[model samples]
Target chain A: EYPHVLLAHGGGGRLMHQLIDAIASTFASAELARRHDGAALRIGDMRLAFTTDAFVVQPLFFPGGDIGKLAVCGTVNDLAMCGARPLYLSVSFILEEGLSMETLGRVVASMQAAAHEAGVEIVTGDTKVVDRGKGDGIFISTAGIGVIEHDRPIGPEAVRPGDAVLLSGDIGRHGIAIMAVREGLAFETEITSDCAPLAAPVLKLLEAGVAVHCLRDLTRGGLAAALVEIAQTAGLHIQLDEAAIPVRPEVQSACELLGIDPLYVANEGRFVAFVPEAEAERALSILQTEPVSADARVIGHVTADGPAGLVTLRTAIGTTRVLDLLSGEQLPRIC
Target chain B: EYPHVLLAHGGGGRLMHQLIDAIASTFASAELARRHDGAALRIGDMRLAFTTDAFVVQPLFFPGGDIGKLAVCGTVNDLAMCGARPLYLSVSFILEEGLSMETLGRVVASMQAAAHEAGVEIVTGDTKVVDRGKGDGIFISTAGIGVIEHDRPIGPEAVRPGDAVLLSGDIGRHGIAIMAVREGLAFETEITSDCAPLAAPVLKLLEAGVAVHCLRDLTRGGLAAALVEIAQTAGLHIQLDEAAIPVRPEVQSACELLGIDPLYVANEGRFVAFVPEAEAERALSILQTEPVSADARVIGHVTADGPAGLVTLRTAIGTTRVLDLLSGEQLPRIC
Candidate 1:
């Protein structure tokens, strides 16, 4: 552990994992022990998923989404990953003094629009302001409550060997989008973030009876981090086909130009689902019907042949390499 | 209405009220329209209360409580105000890069202790780190969900004429304690913050069949703001006896020295309960049984006469004066 908190501690990588583990160990509870994107608890006869996320993305706004939209969508997606229908959200803001009211209005409006799109209501909230330099422009923390309609316990524990791994869409765009704007990188075709709510598609899959064993959204640490976490938690091995994973050309180029791996780049709207191999085609088709996941495809499958808690990636050049968690963040504050 | 967001907008005074109203109008929902400290929600046959609060109190460590304890107790108290037994909380942290790891550990330990004392589980959480100088040492945002066992429909709308207003304990200690530490004020006897979880006392009142009509914690804008907001919402006038309201001598002296009103000072643990006039003594006794509310007393009563949405205070010298919300915050970031 580092003696002082560093930006990497929140990068959703290995450092972030260590930090969360330390915190989780201190606040150990049955629900928190699950270590999923959200905590699923049974309240009487109803099962609810509760989750929280704090957005400290710099610039506040990027090409496709602003901090407001990201805040809402991020929490909603966490609930969605738990196979829950997000119903209500509590939004809290820590605003810096001297921030433009116009900017605040725009962010609030963006939040409203995002909430409406995600079919979730912003029910409760709190606002606190800090001195000008003590805070960035704004930081939005959102907590979401959602209802799990199905009986399937969707999490890493439910993951089984031979389960098909499906990627919802292209990755790396969101990170590239944020990095391009933050680093003043100009590209012929601007790469907008693929930041969209995933509840609709997830609900359709569940409603259509897709036996989703596990679901994880690719966020701060992108596809690699999500896969590594699931593998470690499930005590299983996952094999990924790099050729099958979708990545936009512009985003790939952006990653290459910045000496970053596309697999390590973040994605706000992308998620991977694990289902029985027999149901992979049906799940893919159901996901493809939704515009957000139109690029959905089967990327790989779980296997028991390797050591547990290992993830291997088959490169495009017919080489297999172990995919490991990055120690630090390639781009900080790219939320 | 200001072009830029001033600290007053988050001060929990008139400006904060206006800012909240504007934001609320944009994110209008049935739960939000109620405007209670927490939103009471119905999920299937179960009724739940959900609320969020962000703690940006400077000088993270105060005389009696730290920001970590304050964060947990604040959200728990909000749910208590909704007449709910807080069950779970989601803790999110926005950390500034380069903050000492020891400080983070101490804060987390405090949060765990506070959560344990409040009888709530920290189920889920998120952490984000910003660059040094971009944020204060740390800002904690907590969202809590609690179960509402009773069907009393407690809120301002449930208040009736001739309702007795009860104060749990001394006011102004929390705010003054923070101010003393932040401003380096030397008081002979230190004023420790009255920051503790109020759920136990409130639950006791409800269980004892006190016919509680409304409950509200005195936080940022303190007793004055809570009373005014409740009065305006219930469309009734309230009259308070100044001599009956409890205020510690040290707290009063500090407020006087700082030229701040005790009525407008924040208290983290204290709350006001509105019950039927006939049950005033019973409710006070029930509250006093608990150590947190040992100083419970009748401070005022709701009246239908005179003007609606007015709060009048009767001084010890037989003079009545109107208590209104402060236009700006006397102390910002005091929460």
Candidate 2:
């Protein structure tokens, strides 16, 4: 057992998963047990999705988005991943005593704009200030509630054999962008974070009656962690074509230079959707209608002819390698 | 406008109110404009109440309660003040790196026990860890969703002239208890925080058909801040009998020693119910049924004769004084 919480415990890898499991086991609710991006609930004939996230990014402001924008979009995308139309959000801010009002105003303004873009209302909130040294500039915790319009159960539990895994867009830009700014690395081309709301495209896919089995966002541990988690939870094997996964040239170069794998880097606005092979083309078309998912591609498929919970990737060089969760975090506080 | 956010901005006084107003104006939602403890929402034939709070109590653990218990009880009570039955909660944690796993385990256990006592389920959660010096040991933010069963329009706006204000139990213990622990003050009798879930007593009042106009919990800035905010929101006058306001001898002594007024000190398990003068006795009896509020008493009444947005208190020496929100915080991180 771990004696203390290391930075890796919140790094969105194996350690983070273990920490989450330990805390979740104590509560022991069925909704929590499902372990989806959010908890789906039924209250008086209404189906709602509830989720919460804490954003503790170090720099506060990054290449493409600030912490406020990231906070709103992160929770909104989690609800959207549950195939729910995002509705209301509650934001609670823990600010350090010495934070400038101008900085706070800028963050609040960014949040308002992001909420407007996502069509969600900021309904209620709270604020607490810690002493100057006790807290960073600001840490925002947002909990969102959304309504699920479709009747399908959307989560890892619904994944089945012979399902296609479609990625929404390119990966690794978000983590690289933050790292570049933090480390003062001047890349030939600026790598901006791909942080945007995915609710519109997700809702569009649902409106077109796409048979979506599951959806998972590539957040902290990126594409690999999401796939590994889904494979384990569904007790299925996943096969991926490495060439089909999109990583921007700048991001790929930065990863190579820093000895980081693009597959395990974090993304703010990318997700993978599981659907039947027959509906893959239609789902991709629908997702492409939105700018956020214009680069959507089918990267993998689920299968039952292998060991359960195994994920194998076929490299461009025609070599197969198993993908597993990293014991330590590649990046800390990317979100 | 302030140049930087001060500790007083989160002290639940005038500065806090101003900061909240500024943020709320940017969101511009009617539910948020009400400035209630929680926002009451209507979703598909369901009347829901949503609220969020962040707990940054120093020392982690204090007499009679800890941050974990406070986090659960605070959100639950916010929902209860909305006249709703809290059904589900979303908890998010921000941990500082290097915190002992044992401390986290203890906090999680306390949260579970408190949730069980409050009859609410922790349906969803998230966690993030900051560098050791960037954050306090732990900060917990909880957002609760509760269902309102009654149809009465309850809030400061519903408060009317001739309404009676009934307080639940004594005040000043919670803030004093934390101060005692932090300052290493040893009193003749230990002063423990009155931090407890108030949903049971609140639900009892509603179930008993009490004509409750409004409910306000005595939290951060204590009774004075709650009264002033209510008076200003209702645009009415409130008169209180200071002698009738219960303050235990130990808490009173501690407050005096610290040069703090008991009326401005915070309480965790206390609240005030605004009802018609005719139903005051019945409401008191109903509140007394629950052990959390056994010391319920009628302490004040609403009036229209004085200046609008005014709160007056009658002292034991037959002198009247006006209660106003403090310009600065008396105690930072008391809750």
Candidate 3:
């Protein structure tokens, strides 16, 4: 009975799921109904991954990256999560009138650099301008198409009870970096955004013959959101060791000062990979070869035989607490 | 020498061209620097076309169609213009926080119907909500991927001096329709938008063996914009017969009342196709068989052998005038 869209509906949590479900119910195909990071399609014996993301972060420029880099990396990572080799991207820019041409040049340059580093091409693009008051400076929407070379069935459904959940690098840095700049909150140490492309590392793991079941990038609602979504979609229980999850000290202090949980803070360059318990070490080793994922480690494991849809964290104080989707609005438009 | 973006920069005219050129010049690949309707890519022996467009039309709902319908048809038309069979699309919605759920539902339902008619699947999508005052009601961006079944190399470069220019249907209805609602100008007769899926009729022509050298949809700057862009890109001269171009009486009246030329007005379902003079009759016959293109006619021809990069229109009074890109913005966000 929601009459107006709440900011929480776009927070990548329970309300977002409900909104998607409501909209997708009208689509005729079952593929549209499935909630996957990206859609996989078969074209003349070739498997392709298609994904789209809109970047509307308030401050166009952040500590480490800008909207352009995030626009490319976000869609590229979504395709990577589908076990695809990211190849081509189409970028569309919606700019407000009176935006500086110099600013546009810097953003586009950042996109080119990011695309080059990820080994993907910026093939086609579109541009539109809105009146100054009607829009934030600029919003970028990128749609990516990739070739799926890995034969593994990658999705939430592939996750099993004995799968070990591995995370690539640290979390919470991106959200904190943006928040500090937006709110003018100063910390003892400067915090930088961890916004780097992870396609190379992901493809490396798949090429090395790791049987990865599912992969989800920690964005929007962050690590907790990703885990909760996976648990719900796979109908399984996920148990996490809170001490193992990496959070930078500066980011931790910033989140504490803002009264926000580090686990719910966004990260642009981090992802969670669910691999079979036996191959977890091999996957971690391959991921560690890439600087972007050098801190890869197993942080949790699937721990149920039936449909439980539960996620719990084992805290440092020797107590268990349930982790669910953040129900209220938090850090809107973080990504 | 441009320092800030202007509304004219998004007017699908000279300023817009300069903006794209400035941004694309930094790309490492030449493919990105070239401005085409879509980028053609070869993937392991299969040829595909990828293109994206963002719809920011005001008044969300119009006379004949809504924003959702435009979101689907616009991308489908872009692929068809590349001589590709429209196959799949990824839709992304940027909604304002206060947008009504009922409105969103109707828009999505319209998109579903449009996608169904175009024989394209809404495979993947992303949605983000902005704070209430920061955004217009809704903005939809769609990216489409299609397979190239036609063996002919279709582009402005393929246009020859002896090629005939054919328009699929009437023009100016879409723009006038939106203007009618926004400006509250009422005519004696109602003007409905010609927004429709052009893929079926386009594919029929290709299947019937008509050798189309170039195709461009009449959007934004409308027929004049599409023709001017092609002429400049191909370095050729284009000649048009104003009397032969189809414009409904009501649309003509509306355009006159608004002091706008129908040729420079936007259209959603109309496209201009170029084919050799020898095959023009057969192509027209095949196109006319489809209800969507029943009024198809040859409106002009590629005239000068030299690359003049000029377009001339022969008025009904036997006077000729130069047709140039609209210098200033006429209608903003009319797409």
Candidate 4:
């Protein structure tokens, strides 16, 4: 009866239910049609893991990925990094009116590809079309659930004072690539965004029986922010040798010229693993053995002292400086 | 060391993990910090129900709610409508470079209040700041994990032909309220958005032994869309007496003036309950007995053959016509 949607649809009224029944049940299975927040899934003896994320990245489409890929990857990896095997994802779209169906199609296709690549399923979704100018072209919210082994316990709190930090490949490449494209910076070599599925590699590591204190994918705020968080959480001071941190020449040059620090730059397709001192070398060996992780190295060590556990970088000249959580945007950095 | 976030933070990268951990560990407990996706919590023997949603509503601040309230309630309702008792929520925020901290504080406070009102706790979160011009003010994403009764099997498929459709109350107030304010439409009586949490009322009906076939919140597309969806999903026809559909007088007038149908308007605080005809009066009584559901009524009945699952509305003239989902945004009609 509505010629235009009244505010009541969002009011959780009869209309909202109808819209959900039509859109969600049309594609989802009878199970999803039950209209529960999550489908009650039974997966072997493994522990069930769940996650959700919202995508509001403007310009929806960037060089390497768009909101679609980010939505899928963000949820899938959230599960995967937590020692879970991703199984399904539920996607919801808030589309502004007048958006081209073609764009939506492409975005959905990209999501499909990301899900397929991660060996997950997009089982349910909702589409809400807003008035033109009422919203941007699109906003996506994705929720993911997975199955994890009960034996695998991964997180920052697991890190001991003597644990060594192992990095998967180089840092700042993804951050710099985005910056280059976003800021229109010139580079001697063109850098590409490092956006990819890490479920496979992470699964491989889990299978190897390596004891990992934590496994976190460094995406935003880079390695520096991650280290600081881990240090503060675990109550241990983290010291990293600047020279030990790996950064590609192109990324480094861009950072130097832009007056941005590579440590705080964002990176996709990379991860940080905190391992015990005794197991650090083995972890590095296992990581470097994989082609996806060619530049793996032990970049820092956790200590028990200094300001109740902070992350600091030791310069080549032997001076130390605090590495703090960035409170602002690292614009001109997302190439 | 994130100098600026690239698309990779949304990627499953080092940046993404740090970004998540930075916020997660900031206020999380030791146990929660260890869980990959906002604490794989164990509360007694109840299996968990997980849900995720992203809020991209235009005008982050609206009549009765803001993006923050919607973010919290959207996920909370998703869990509640599933008949789950919501426990914890995970929040993610994507902020534009220039967004003031004051606005963010207001949003956070609103979310905190909503969470408190729903009796759920905010456990973990993620934050990312995009460059200026690349984003609007702010976008918030929330994911919730709740617990539901093991035997609460609710869904469209559970619906049978002879079921009664019970609406919690009213229609189209939310959409119209947003529209009116956005368009500067003057009215004798100002309409506010109906964005209240429905968990309490739903729990009340369940407690009264309503034995509902399914329960769904009518959002986005309003009553027409919600009913049509239910009809199609349950594979049954629906017949509604237009006069029985309860719309506020002002809302009805507004719909008529705007060439809009209240049935197609969106509602945020209402829901549809498909129950056995025997339980119809009881459900209505139980609903109407509550302060939140005082307007609960039986607007329609599920049928077997005629129209084969189409929704037909009987008008005041004693004639019936099909009701369809609203195609897109009717922006001018919001409150």
Query: Global lDDT of each model?
Result: 0.94, 0.94, 0.90, 0.67
Candidate 3 lDDT for residue A23: 82
Cα RMSD of all models vs. native, in order, equals: 0.8, 0.8, 1.2, 12.1
What TM-score would you report for chain A in candidate 1? 0.99
- In candidate 3, what are the lDDT values of residues B1-335, reduced to their tens digit? 87898888888887888788877777655566446789889888889999999998998999999999999999999999888999999999899998999999999999999999999999999999999878898988999999998678888888888899999988999999999999998888888899999988889989988989999989889999999988988888999999999999998888888899999999999999999999999999999999989999999999776447888899999999889988655788897
How would you encode candidate 2's per-residue C-alpha lDDT over A1-335 as one tens digit per residue?
A: 88999999999899999999999999889999998999998988999999999999978998899999999999999999999999999999999999999999999999999999999999999999999999989999999999999899999999999999999999999999999988899998999999999999899989999999999989989999999999999999999999999988999999998999999999999999999999999999998989999999999999989779989999999999999999869989999
- Give the lDDT of residue A104 in candidate 1: 93
Interface RMSD of each: 0.6, 0.6, 1.0, 16.1
Candidate 3: misplaced stretches above 4 Å? A305-307
lDDT string for model 1 (B145-244, tens) is 9999999899999999999999999899999999998889999999999999999999999998889999999998999999999999999999999999
DockQ for each model:
0.91, 0.90, 0.82, 0.06
Q: Which prediction has more favorable TM-score, 1 or 4?
A: 1
lDDT by residue (tens digit), candidate 4, B1-335: 54432333322223334444443332233422322112222333445555565565667787788878887887777676666667666666656556665676677778878888888766444444444554556666677776665465666667888898898888888877777767677778888778877778777777766787777777656777667766776778999988887888888888888887777777777788888999999888888877768898998898886778699999989998998654343442221
Predicted complex 4: CAPRI docking category? incorrect
Among residues 3 or more apart in sequence or in different chains, the pairs in candidate 2 whose N, CA or C atoms overlap within 3 Å are none
Indicate the DockQ of the complex predicted as candidate 2. 0.90
Total clashing pairs for each candidate: 0, 0, 0, 80
Q: Candidate 1: misplaced stretches above 4 Å?
A: none
TM-score, cand. 2 vs. native: 0.99
User: Each prediction's TM-score against the native?
Assistant: 0.99, 0.99, 0.98, 0.78
Candidate 2 deviant stretches above 4 angstroms: none
Model 2, B10-62: lDDT tens per residue?
A: 99899999999999999888999999999998888889999999999988999
**Candidate numbers, best lDDT first, in rank order:** 2, 1, 3, 4
